[model samples]
Target: MSVCKHIRNQGYSQREFLVLRRWAIYPHPSVPHYTNKLFTHHELQHSDYLSQLCIGYRHILFWARWVVTVIWRCIFCAYHKLFGRKYTPLPPIEDLALVQSATTLAEWIRRGKRSAESVVRAYIHRIQTVNATLNALVDERFAAALEEAREVDHRLASLTKQEREALADSHPLLGVPFTCKDNIKLTDMNHTGGIVSRRGIKAEQDAVVVARLRMAGAVPLGVSNVPELAMWCETSCTMYGRTNNPYDVTRTPGGSSGGEAALLSSCGTALSIGTDVGGSIRIPSFCCGTFGHKPTSGWVSLEGAGLFPDALNDSFGIQVVGPMCRCARDLTLALQVMAPHAAKDLASKVQHTDLRDLKFWWCEGLDTPLCSPLDPALRHALTAATHYLSTTFEAPLEKLEWPRDMSIATLMWNNKLRDDYRGQPPMTVDMTNRKGRVSLLAEGLRWLCGRGRFTFPLLMMATFQKLLAVNEDPQDSPHYWKPMQEFLMGTLGKTGVLLLPTLPQLAFLHHEFVPNMLDFGHTCIFNTTEMPVTAVPLGLSKDRLPLGLQVVVSPGQDHISLAVAQALEDKFGGWVSPVPVTV
Candidate 1:
């Protein structure tokens, strides 16, 4: 049989077949040029074989690491308990103008209590003061935002209180200034998205969410930075520099949407737009001490956004554009603006539950199979949260088992991507300014020689992850994690929520993500399982870094999760401002 037919019979897609063909014609870093043809033509299945082997070995490593992480966690946590108590105090929030929530600010602007331009200016000043240190605001429209805010104030002047209230319904966020992750388009702004090649590119249009916010009277201040292609967990890229945590300049802000988290926590913007696939929104929010919400899949529009695999067209529902802010209320407001069509229905469905009837399941710092045990501070935060709810609100908090074994969750998420890709044209993975494929091996050599357009993580993903085939995700089904989703929904029903770890530990130091990669997997599970998760901050840890947990609810029951987040915020004081020591 022909090599093409052999690979086809083995169920490789035309895309995969072309990849193998490319290997035969092009030079490989590891394979000799003379032997390339013989290798691809005769042993095409070897690529798939290598992929499966690596994937299996990764799972084996997961369990092996699981054993060591648990034992080490106990000893390390004890050591920290005795000695790790120093904290660098956060500078006081210098401006009272930055303290109000988006909802409060908008109301004040409408009532002529506070000028909208003043609010915009306050935030812009904050951005300017911090961006030098944080590098969070990559693109700016500060002048344009001020003008828009002026227009809003002018329009509101002629309206009565009732009329202003009516206006608030349609333009709920009117007069509030906001920023979005670079992946979300802001018209006439550089959407570099942290990739080197796209340095001077401009967004010709506003992302759907951005437009909705504008329509609602929220002025756009700028776009924030993201990791290249919004792929990796950290936000630094070749184009824009790294974004530092406001809580501690020494630690990272968490990636993909790390800039958004850093900016929000620093009071650069009370609310901002962000996207998440593999815990991008949740992790950064956890790191920078902010509130973030990943809405139920298909709950928000993805039009004009750069989310991979097209969440709008795909059913996997893992990738989503969401809200990252300093307050839980902003999450609901942002979601409403993003999906205005569903606002009424969602509001009606999201009813207040009696504390007694709400089924609250929690995990108090148990170690997951592949992730390190939760840090003592984070574990204590969870215990405090559950204890507060149980005693104060009489919430029925129960200890529950999370994914001690993530082998199934990872496979389910992988299958989800496969199904999403098959539905759409496969996502492009190039880093050059031009819109075309480039040689992975060629890029690697350039990188080694100190001249590469792509980041190291992107290269690694392109090489082995693309070449090495993992086990086939079941092609017959669109709902890859259907059983798991159903089980979770059935368990939570309508009146239940789960408070779980946002990450295993507090934010790590900058460039220290590689070792804790497994812990980030904790966020990915919810994306695949298809639930609404709200990152609720539980004040700062003893180390003065952010401490938080996720409030997850059944599919379509986002209001329940949002409510739980509010309750927790009320008790714990959500998203403490992480000002610099000199602020």
Candidate 2:
């Protein structure tokens, strides 16, 4: 049978037949015209049959390619895991303090100048030496960290020089040790958030930001402590006790991410991942005298990093995961790795605004009653920072008032908390069971008697939540929040950066924050507005406590706040190491 008759018997559509006929008659453009004339009808029919067979074969090959790709990926991954490069012994790094920034450390590792194992060992040794007195690390994964470092070293050593260079180009954070706030999850780590009830719960997998950091070759040392539920700005919980400031063990290191900041400040770790809703990250960074950037809301993924199961949805617009580092450049590097797409878009637009070309709006304090008067030393630090910027950058500085009413900001923040926890059982519920017994109260009384299972601040925060519940008027919140949001976004939009006090006073003595919790008004304003804020250390106070300022900018302009932080770091000498305390 002719090829056309055979196709018709096989049920080929008239459209298909016409297409084949046209192709056969005209020939493909690539085929020679003379060759087309030489083919008789029988030859054309055979060619058409062959073409159909080729089409069928191509479909089979397409599916086969996918299977082969999948199998190859599996084999490659298994092989890489089994036979990856091994760590080479190196001369002891006598002073780990030399590797100040993750950026520089990663560059050195990529260049084959430093072994990943050495970097990990340096941080582990520092943690061992200081963590006893600082109490910064809630848990230590020394063995696991060392093993991962060895794996990294092995992988690099196995690669050719060119392959090593390619890996370095891909993994900018290669071989750097970093800490994660206890609230930010890492597989097999205790994500306690400092709550006793969660003491045994392990994260099933890494949080999105944690996974990204690992992909970029950053090794996690372990989880750091936080206040119970991370609600208060003091790093004390029934689970891990308290994390003291490296500068003065007598004072707080700031809570939530306090341990992360303390570790970074004390040079126990080079980089850390922290979250901020109402200054959790920045407050601790300020207290510890380190650099921290609270990225624009939703800029960093919150997957697997939640206090409650529904934390992401609950704290939708306010909460964010961000980077904390001893150096400003590491903040940008970590952010880029954590949120590659957003950071890329931000980098494209955020040219470093030369200090001379930048405009500054300075606010000494908030107008709200909640704002505590800035300490004399803190006031002086801000003044000095302003003066340094003005003189060094020759930039203009204008004294700007805290816009959009502080009362409204407070109300909006409270409303957010209310909305965040609405319908969910109160934290007090964690202390009760099916019997309805309030274990927390019993624990609180025991605590009063010096045998408590819960910390004082956690108990106070729970009681305060009840009081707030009684006073909450969610209906009235939007009325105030809408205008405040509009005013803030309009005032600081893109070009402007607001410099404000990170805290009313320097790191206060432990437990002092309980009565003065409202003092967070200065920091909470930006949280409520969802704007990016970077806490930059402005040297130390007269008492030797860390002094700092908050650089605020509009949403998605994280680079602006970070740029200002870098500039300020250059002038003020960022993150002066605390004198190590002997236990």
Candidate 3:
């Protein structure tokens, strides 16, 4: 398309105008001397004009990102100046039960060292104490949860030691407490997914994963918050406002599983159930200083929980429900309860692998779409870990390589979701409901005045998704998606693992993701590959917020990633309680 049509199609926003003017006025250093010296009137005729114009456009777009960043940073500063520290500070974890892992908690409850009722009550109190500050626990089932706890205690009291061992094998987490993300239904609890129109809705039944956990004797504490339809990375919506990070309430807790991570980090719950499509589960875990695992594709059921389709695995991957926890071992325990049929086999695979037999590869970000640079703290932490692994384990941490050409990565992803397929979401008309698709133009304009029914991030998502030019020949590009999978699977093989910064940067202030939305490709691309990943909290940054990295392994290797997470926990402390970050 020509520049004129491009501007007309874009509607010439302020940023576009600035970019066009800069492109026309600037003389790129790489341009020949004759162009600047004698071709002022004949520049368009120059051989490099189009290529240089493309370069100049890219240059201006790069600067435009920073300009948007400065603008958002200023808004944050003004907010603090006016609000005078409005968010409440979370009290440090004072109860011993709140600090223990779900795995340990359950063992204690079964062995009679602790009462199941007391453990449930401890989490209930912590959630009550922090929800006012974190806005994470959106709906509670405290009374019901307490009742369930009593039953667990009563049942265990009658069981013989041999029976308890059998119970431990059959129901590993019997008496542990866990929170559920709002999108993952909890019977009689809020199921809004942060959409204002869906405000009064409640779930009639537990999601499949939730049911499994319940059957295993785990008690449900509450439902956590989410972005609209679980689309955005930072958790906030018109219905539930925004969920804040406990370490620094001024920043985000990453979404759409953000609420669960924040609650776990703040000692509100030892474990939680959350769904991931892009990096929903891992991103929040990264920001909150907790552990989260996105299981191998189809390893966990999505029934009654996920809004996205499952066919993405056969075509281009997208959704799965997985466990998020404070400690790494709890991830293994939770997955066993959630997918008991596959537990024994997976346990055997994970136990057989040794770190010495594994190879390591690391990548800063995806080669296709541009990601914001990793924060210095994130970079330093990842580098340090790589160094430790290479020296401590006597393995080389080599740089990862991408396929020769991956420009089609974004198109393939968009086409898969946009194409007609079974189980496909109603993206043809987003913000959909019983009423139907919303008018993007109308809703987007209303949002400008701060009176819209949807959040800006949700609208932004709607706009970008609709803007993808429909692919009339999606069949021709199925081959394009293969290179990434082949490269990842072939290189990693069975026992190999790849390391990546959990995200490009540490968690930013709420809404700051608007300008850098494309960065999610870092996590989304992995989802498309169906690889299993565990987000491990390395430690705190200089600013006291969480710093983390992704430990990705070949498909069907969920346990390998989990095992590595446990090893990391031993080498570097995992899931430290968040302290207030004055900054």
Clashes of each: 6, 2, 0
What does candidate 1's lDDT look like per residue over 471-558, in tens digits?
5554444225555555566667887888888888788666556555667667887877778899899999877888999998887778
lDDT of 1: 0.74
Per-residue CA lDDT of model 3 for 305-399, tens digit only, reads: 84433533423355778899988888888888787766646666666767877888987765432446556788888888887777888876788
Local accuracy by lDDT, each model: 0.74, 0.74, 0.76
Scored by lDDT, model 3 comes in at 0.76
Which candidate achieves the best TM-score against the true structure? 3
Of the two candidates 1 and 2, the one with more favorable TM-score, higher being better, is 1
List candidate 1 segments past 4 Å from native: 1-92, 307-316, 345-351, 364-369, 402-404, 423-428, 432-434, 467-480, 580-583
For model 2, the run of ten residues with the poorest summed lDDT: 27-36
As a TM-score, model 1 comes out at 0.81
Steric clash pairs (candidate 3):
none
lDDT of 2 by residue, 306-366 (tens): 7565657524777888999988878888888999988974543444556576677888866
**Candidate 3, superposed: residue stretches over 4 Å from native:** 1-75, 81-85, 307-316, 367-369, 404-412, 419-425, 428-430, 469-471, 477-480, 580-583
lDDT at 177 for candidate 1?
Answer: 87
